[model samples]
Target: MKIGIIIPARNALPYLKEMLNSVQAQTRPAHAYIAEDRSTDDTHEWLRDHPDLYAGMRRNRRRLGWAGSLNAAAALALADGCDALFTASADDRLHPECIARCAAVLGADGGRDFVVPYAQQFGEAEHVQASLPDAGLDDLVRWPPLIDKALIRREVWEQVGGYSAKATPPGTFGTAEDWDWWIRVWKAGFTRYSVVETPLYFVRVHPGQLSDARAEHHAATVDLLAKLHPDLPWTAESRQWPPQHRTTRRQG
Candidate 1:
């Protein structure tokens, strides 16, 4: 299966070179795309000069937010006829075998819709938990299982109607889009697995990281999402997952 890699970029100038270099160093390098989200920094200028890193590069006329940029990249990857799309952040790095291993697992079992590789957190904000308010106590307790660097089949992505780009008041529209999408995927009968043997992703946590900067906004959005999808089990025992429990699958 052909895998397409998409990097949703904003003011990622600091991490862009390292991120692109890692992709190029992949054991089985896949087609790469950058959805530049009107970065205030030199992100767009650098991307324009480095044509080799990305097969297709497009800049948003205005900032599309994280979810919007990812949606754009996913669309481009799908249109390019990729069997699956792999998503990474400009601030993170993927191991050389990440894409290859995810593809192998997905290809081996047609029943598996997506593969989420283990990620090791690094940088200034490593392992830092978000501050949660007492009002959203339940949402705070159970952080959704995050597939930091995930490879998802096109069919699964399409089935969920892509990430929600709508900006809800109190929280940005795309806030918690990844968690929301995963919940929808499970609700739609698709299965996702985590690769625990090897931590194939490196997530950099810095001062400007979106999650850290807008923790409250994200929490509010997640609370709203849980309300909308009550069956998601956001507070269930499966919250501490991956090696914490067996891979989730629908009962026969």
Candidate 2:
């Protein structure tokens, strides 16, 4: 299956090298695409200089936020006739076998809509972020069970309308876009999802990362999600952020 890796980046020059290296090291080679979201730094220039790293790249004229940037790159990959799309963070790294393993599962099982690999948090903090086996809509509504970086079928992405580009309140980025999109995908009747137990995705956890913003705006995000998905059973308890039970800890 033809797979396209989409990376959304802004002011991410410091992390791009490691991230791109991992992408290039994939056991099953896949086309890489980058959406440079008008970074204040030299991220755009760097990407422009290293044109060969990605199959296609775009530099947005203005900030598109996380989801919008991802959509922009995903559009390019889709136009290139990719059968599957993998959305990855500019700051994260993937295991060499990540693409081959996830693609193999999807290729083998027609019933699976997407495959999420277990991830580990590194950088300032280190911990294992386990993937939920056979996750469903109920698991997603309660908490984000699937990592944002997942290998999804192209049909599933088109059917769910890609990630939401909804505007957030002024001065805030929409940190829950991944969670929101997963909910929509599940609600759209693509309930079959799988989890690759290996920790193939490595997430960098440092100050000023999106996870920090997610924690800061947890209540507002939950409220917004409730508004968007009124049919779901949202409660006051849902507004409270769920604690992540780290399965493993390693020295950073």
lDDT, candidate 1, 1-252, per-residue tens: 777888899999989899888888889868888899999999999999999887778999887888889888888888888888898888888888887887787777554677776666676544422211111223323554544357888898888877766424353535556656666666677754544346677778665553343545545655676677666556533233221322221110
Clashing residue pairs, candidate 1? 166-173, 167-173
What Cα-based lDDT does every candidate model obtain? 0.68, 0.81
User: Which candidate ranks first by TM-score, i.e. highest?
Assistant: 2
Please provide TM-scores, in order, for all candidate models, with all chains considered together.
0.80, 0.91
TM-score of 1: 0.80
Q: For candidate 2, what's the RMSD?
A: 2.9
